[model samples]
Target chain A: MISNRLFIRLLAFAALVAVIAAIFWSQNPAFLSGGNIRALMRHMSVQGLAALGLTFVIVVRHFDLSFPGVASMGAMTLGWLIASGAPFPAAIAGALAVGLVFGLVNGIAVARFGLPDIVTTIATGGLAVGFSYFYSNGTSISQNFFMSGILDLNDKRIIGLDMPFAILMAAAGVAAVVLHASRVGAGMYATGQNRVSARFAGIATRRLIVLAFALCGTMACLAITLLVASSGAANVTAGGQLLMPAFAAVYLGAALFGRPSVGATLAGTLMMSTMLNGFTLLAIPYYYSDAIVSTVLIAAIAIFDPRLSGLLNFRKAAA
Target chain B: MSALTADIPQRRRGADFLMRYAFFILVAVVFVAFAILRPTFVTPGNIHGMLMSASIAGLMFLGLTWLIAAGEIDVSFMSVAALANMVTAALVQDGQGWALASLGGLGAGVAFGLVNASLVAGLRLPALVITIATGALAASIAAAIGLGTSIALNNTGFVGQVLGLRVGVLPLIAVIVAGLYAVSWFVQERLTFGHYIYAMEQNRAAVVEAGVPVNRMLFMLFVLSGVVSSLAGVLLAANLSSGQPYLGTSYFLDGLTAVLLGGMALKLGKPNVLGTLAATIFLIGLLNGAALLGWTDSQRQIVRGSLLLVGVGLVVFARSRRKT
Candidate 1:
């Protein structure tokens, strides 16, 4: 069974890589082109920024459904600040502050009220979207000269890859070190594994949960910046479509990286994005594209926990 | 002795009746407030429209209440409903009779529900996760086979008319919904399965110790939910005269809101079917009234989502209080 699990993940990875290679070969005939790889990496970086925060939330067994709302709020607020003649650094800081407040509200709701994660987040998500819509007045934010400097992060490459790609890699590294190499990360895992036990162990489970939300909100804030720089527009619906892909990445990370690891989440984001990019390049039908993602998600669930596949003879609750 | 016994039963009956009906009174108060705000809101025709609007979805909630009360979720119902609609539509298009279409839709619903139950019961997977995955899978499969477009029923014939007709100014769907509530109430309050479902919900380990096939009971609950949901979908297809993949999304919030709002406490073991039916009407009334008051679509979504949040909060609070 262990071998079977490994083989399936390996197949998933191999398939992802093969699809990318095929797309590259068909489009440019220069499969190893530096510019193309850099471009892909640049896109991956923006997606990674948001996916990283989502990883923190999901690993702790709570989903941040309000992520898109937070992201849109941050992005539009940043654009508004920049448009009002703020410096780049100040605009970014202001955006992060907005995210922080939203995160705090979510933390208070979940920790103090003991609300169900799904209920609280779904409500907060709509609230955030509503706030964003009201704030933006149902229009996309305009680009500014200051925003142009932020966009340059995608254009500059170190050696053959873009700086944004490197930044994404560095962010993943930090997440890994914090989660696996630190006490706080252990506390998060403890809290998620069993709240009652974690509280008994003096883990300050509530605070750690709050910290997880803050991290998620911060990451989403940063991702909004990157998204704005890349797409040059901050519409209300900009962050909505990313939810599915973000969720897909987290689940894929669990399947690929040995359960909810930050590194796994990062890898999953890249893999999912690459799949979409390659499929589009290959001229696959839209419905088929959806089919592929759904199939992979289910396959991952079945493979990651074989007993959960319902193939065993006893047919009893084992997991 | 006969007089004393009669008094005792009368007192208990009064309390039970109040416990069952207090929530409906609360709804009536809200309805009065809305009617006062908008004079036309309480009109007979508008009230009938509201009942028709909620009937199909309210019926689905009747089934879902049992599954949720069993401490398991079946989010796959909407997707299964979509599949059932598409299959029935396809059958009808292929020159099959209406009865066959309805049967096909219901049978497929049960089969899919069985699949969901098997996943949750046999595999020990989390019900929420399993249902979500399978739901998406089912939806994708349906879309793939749906001829790459939405299907509209052009010919009514006898089957369509019977399913679609109104009975004494009330939609047939509304009658079916009332019938479903009665059946669900009987099964939950009077049947043996109801006892087992409650036992499992309260303490599954104890139920297993008693050598009851807990998995089978839970599985059957999901199957029941699926079959009922498909029936709802067929009724919907007749009413709307079309089938589309995206049509089921709204029902997710609708059914969830009704079940939660109708005093269906999590700790109560099984949900109140009659209460759920009333709550369904409440929601329908609120939406229709909001529309008449000139609220925009986005405002409607915001209202619905917020109302659901409040309902969930109430349930959580009630459950905690009962514990105290």
Candidate 2:
């Protein structure tokens, strides 16, 4: 159920996006081209899917810093499997399986053993990346990847949307259902808001925490795996660059909605991807994108924080 | 609950005692096994080399010890270090004296830390996100100034000589690090502020009720982290004879591992200077031994990651067992 306030804000955001799009289009006629739109979707889905996954962990008040590691491992697994004569579907499953295992370990460690979320994820992620490094010894795994049908699948369109976007939509649909319209979702939200009270209410907060993390890690990997298929080579360092942008998207969503929600995350992902896309189309130096991400991230979080809200009320977050 | 804990099975008590000493046992076993398997590993030259490599990360870990003890985290300091590193290198390249360059770098790090403290401690924002934001800013600034490349120091010979000052076969940096740890130990074990920081970590409400200044304590911890990290950057520059805009990040995993591994040792769930010091040695030894055994970089990293989890798991299990 969308609140009236959120609905109005969404409309206003759409207007802002439209204005930005017009400005970009005025600068470059190819800004709204079909191929460019597809390319943008492909790029956005990577951060989009990862940010969607991150929403769960953040809502539960936990962080999984291991996404980059796990995601790289997933991509590496796909590349490694394909290079070793494995069938494409089997290779995809292999990558997802690796993601699931890592996610499960992360959740179990945090929920069962009571480890800190940050360091545990960092350790596990590092372990995953270390393992990923072994397949090619720090080189990109490119053998047989081009000959595989992955590129076809990666670019294939389903209902006018690319494969990556299609996957993103399916995942987002599932997230929207599970996070908003389900009993377990409510329990998860309650757990995030107050763990002790959720436990007293018989919510099985630990199990929900585990579930949130498992889903988070798996989706993070899925996003990166699809992205690697698009890029055609899997390097151990490929996922490192995704952290700031994806994090910005998730936090931006949470700030927009007063808390993390599925739709807001998707919207935030769209905004971030488009902004980066615009930057690419413009004559801006590529290095400035990192600065832009940092600014947006700080601004997004700063606005919602009570200490800065008074300063922000006349500006963005008054809505 | 107290009465129930008064009696325990002898077998369980033995297990508990072993659990408490497991870190030392592991360290000893690894060291002795390495020495026996490779006699050359115990040579003074190799030990000195290890000590030399350990000091930079050791310095950062010491600062992190304070932050972690206060229940705060800084993902930004390394990036801040990178900023400091590049600033020093850039200034040195501009024909600045060593003192001026060092000050320029340390100033950048200090400013970054104070900003982090204000947002995290004053505004009560989440530390991770704020630090990450600041970290990104620092890295960006470093890259912008350094043109996204590394800068070599101007007076390499002189810088090396200064940082490499030795007294009676002991590198002055190592001595300084040890002295710094002694100061940390003094503050942690003997000072009221140290006790207050720990108490704040354990229970913020109780500390507030007692009218302790929480924000000031947080500022001190973060500033300490930033200052030490900045110094680590300078030492790192001397070690490498060059500084990259993103170089300090290479030490992040090493720093965190040492700090967390330390938490599982002497203090057993509490991050402390002695634990960081010992764990730093243990970590450097593990890496050194792996290299001596012809292990690949991947293999060393894999082992290090696994040990990190195991160490944290032991800390968790120890806490649970003690509570029960």
Candidate 3:
């Protein structure tokens, strides 16, 4: 039954995307050019990776406000290490480690100590950003860093797709399989749906939550690596702007899928990236685009809940 | 059974006492530590600065206490304040009187508050999500209305001179903060509205079933929050002598920190105005002390962030322990 609904939604979304694409193409032929398409894909891939991690946390009915902090810290860590003559692999490993530790702290605070997820993540995120700023001395790192490997990886295309795009797609495929086909995935969904029943049914709900957070942290690290490599520098505010779009994508995915899923999230991410690219081509200011996206997100959430829609009707009737 | 019941009440009373006085004790400790570490911390000038800092945050905290007690949250108050400040400053820059311009700013805040109230109360959407959208929207509107980034206020105006006024050794803003706190205390502790707020937080269904207009009350509370926060923004602009688009960005976090650090429970509807005031003062003192000790802004932020985490953790832990 869920799959049937999912299939219908996916088809509808695809149709909508095509219509939007046509509109953009009419406005500017360059919107569909090969170079522009590749650039759009790269942008979508960066956002998708973060949204993918967020998908894991949100599926379990939790919010992780720490992703921006984690990404910035990871990027700064990598940049600082590479600038200090550290090996590329070592820098990557260090960044990953930082992400894992931060994720673990958040998971423990929420799952074990029963702290509110949003509050805990917000605090941890602030700490993470602070550390990044302190480490970078409040300046963007633009020193000589080992970029040959990253540049080469990005350049390596397969079947006319950027390497980063391929990696993101592969990640989404694996996530879909795990979520739809694996036992642990079932446990996670059950935990989110009803904790008491899941516990009664012998699921280690706390452990599942912790694992979800860990995966989220690791994914953030990978996303930041791509960002730093592509930009060849790390700024104190580097991952701060990704939070809103990532969140909108995650919720939109849930609205479409009737639940959170990586595939749905990737679709949502692509739609957003495409819309943003089109908006840019049309010379619309960034703020207007943000306002529109947030409105859509709120509307999507409202539409997904039958109760909320019913309440809206009742309000109208009263008025 | 009788003995167990008696013992439970006694234990609960003891816990309540500790919760009430914990913040005060923490404030004293912070004061002493700073005094010992930094020779200039106890000076009259630094003390005045700390009080002045507390006034703005304290006013916002007053509004937050009411909303949190009613089981709602508004993260957009800061944005509303920023928008209000910009409006007031822009009007003043256009040669309008300070009284009319400040009123205009407050009106803008009330307008935004109504939008929030309609969405949150009428539509039943989560307060957090709706407020986040409104906040972003408010910021965009502020930027669009020619308030681009920052604008210098006309310092020769009444708004500027009044905010800068001091009563001998005390700032006028501090007196306003004190007056606001007294009114809030009266509203929370003396009025039937306060009773309704607590009742709603404890059990919304019960309050609604008991003939209370829950939605209307919530709408009013949000408007009150908006008005107070905007007033803070106005005073902030007057103090800085410039209107900044991002001035209120840090207030949301700082307000939350003060509220939680003041021993307000996240799960319970307990309002602690005194504790909140003390927490604000403690936070300012800590920041001033850090400056005196020659710590960088990054280091101070790290300390503040960690303190927020620990403070919230302690409150949550205490609440859970009491439940057990």
Candidate 4:
């Protein structure tokens, strides 16, 4: 007999397909045109990278509301460096470094200091925004990085596909390989599914938690690079607005892959990004697009075997 | 001194309460400091304006404390508030009765809450994830319904008449907000339902195992939240005399800040009503004082961030000491 899990998942995928089709049917049936498809891919890539990083931290059962903040900081640092006559590669490296340091701090606080996840991340996100604001002097950075030839990563396309998409896919591939094929992945999963059990199994639970955060931070850095490349400017609010969408993608993606895996999260990101793209193409009002996406997320999770949510209910009900 | 050390536990509880609530006190300190420094923050109009802006956010915080204390978070409360405002506006524009419109808005909010409860309690989704989804979805629906057209209540209609009536020294909206806090406090302290929620928060599984219908209780709380938020929303619409689609996002930050500042840590699983109320007022005072003092928006954000960090830091330290 087919498991309820399989049935629900199939139903979810079907719902996703239907939404995609409905969006295309309403707006531009030709949204499937090659050019539009490529553009959508690039859009998905930016969000997908951030979601991939978020998956690692979340799967370990920790919240990182600071991704957008960190990503924005990275983007601003990169853009600022590039504008200030820094070399192209150095600007990118500096951006990634900012993310790395922030991630380390987050990991240490969560692991060593035992700060609650959401509260800490929220506070850190504020700090990141503050740093970004100070760096940008409370204004949008409008100096064109593209104009200076400091960043060509966004402009370079391979086989009609944007370079950012390629870069994101490469990052996703590495995450997938490390998570699925390596022992570190197993440790991470063990820690997430059951920390006590993982500890009993001799896994260094705190180390795993820190590592997950670091990976997430690195992923966010990658996403910021793409976003800055696409927009060619950075501001304090550049990634602030992305917090909700990123949350949506992470949670909604978890509903799909049964956990936050690199592959499943990528699927969730594509589902959301393309749905938004398709809605815009079809001339669906912004409000309607929000409604449709929200419906899809809730329906996707709820319709999936009641058992999946049942476990969570048991804890909530019991507590 | 030796005797004092022996009484440390008793003394510390009082101290912890005081320190945990220092953010609220800090608000007064900030106000006084700003007044001394700039001499403008003490003006009556600026104080009233700050209180008024905070009352809108404060109304939602009172309800949210119960939900958060019960170990269920409804981030979509703000979305519900915005939707309630939008519906009220749309109704008034369409020539609907004011009373009838308010009822409809509350009903819609409760329905949204039910949806959230069903997903979180029935289907077992994490409150964080479900609330995030619902919050986004609710905002979208609100935006979709409003259709990018903000309805201003300035026209000679039922909403206009209701909104136009401001009580002397306090808007009707402000009065309604005070009423909400009173009701929320009563529900939190005087009711057995509040006790059950605290029990549920401490150990939801234990509460469920004791043969209580945890799902139903939690679901009801969410519905109650919807009602509270909707009431706030309708009042906000009347006060503002218009409904903006994205207006609810500010409430999200403000409500969360109020809850945390109020010293009700989610980890503690107990809702401190008075503490939260005090914190709400304090935050409003700080922001209002800052604005009056000619602090830039960025400077205000920095101060807000610093206050939040300090507040949470103190609470964490106090809680850890108590536990140990």
| Model 1 lDDT tens row, A1-319 | 9879767766877787687677657775644466556666777787787888877777678867677777777877877777777887888898888778878777767876676665566666666666676655768877584444766755666766567777788888898898889988998898889989999999898888887888888888877777776776667666765666677788877777567878778778877777766666566665667668766776776666645344543455554
Residue A17 local lDDT, model 1? 68
Give the TM-score ranking, best first.
2, 3, 4, 1
Which sequence of candidate numbers ranks them by DockQ, best first? 2, 4, 3, 1
Superposed model 3: Cα runs more than 4 Å off: A1-4, A146-148, A308-319, B1-20, B146-148, B190-192, B264-271
Residues B12-122, candidate 4: write the lDDT tens digits: 756855674455566677767878987767676665666677676777766678787787777889999989988877877778877887787788788888888788877
What is the Å distance of residue B36 in model 1 from its true position? 2.7
**Ten-residue segment with the worst summed lDDT in candidate 2 chain B?**
B153-162
Q: Residue by residue across B282-319, what tens digits does model 3's lDDT show? A: 77887788888888777877877787687677777777
Worst 10 residues of 1 chain B by lDDT: B263-272
TM-score of chain B of each: 0.84, 0.92, 0.89, 0.85
The pairs that clash in candidate 1 are: none
Candidate 3: residue A319 Cα off by (Å): 22
| Residues A191-248, model 4: lDDT tens digits | 8889999999998989888888888777788787878777778776767656666666
**Stronger candidate by DockQ (2 vs 4):** 2
TM-score of chain B of 2: 0.92
Runs with alpha carbons beyond 4 Å of true place in candidate 4: A1-29, A158-161, A305-319, B1-18, B155-176, B264-270
What is the Cα-based lDDT of residue B217 in candidate 1? 83
* Regions of candidate 2 where Cα sits further than 4 Å from its true position: A15-34, A283-286, A310-319, B1-17
Give model 4's DockQ, 2 decimals. Answer: 0.53
Query: Pick by DockQ: which candidate is best?
Result: 2
Relative to the true structure, candidate 3 reaches a TM of 0.90
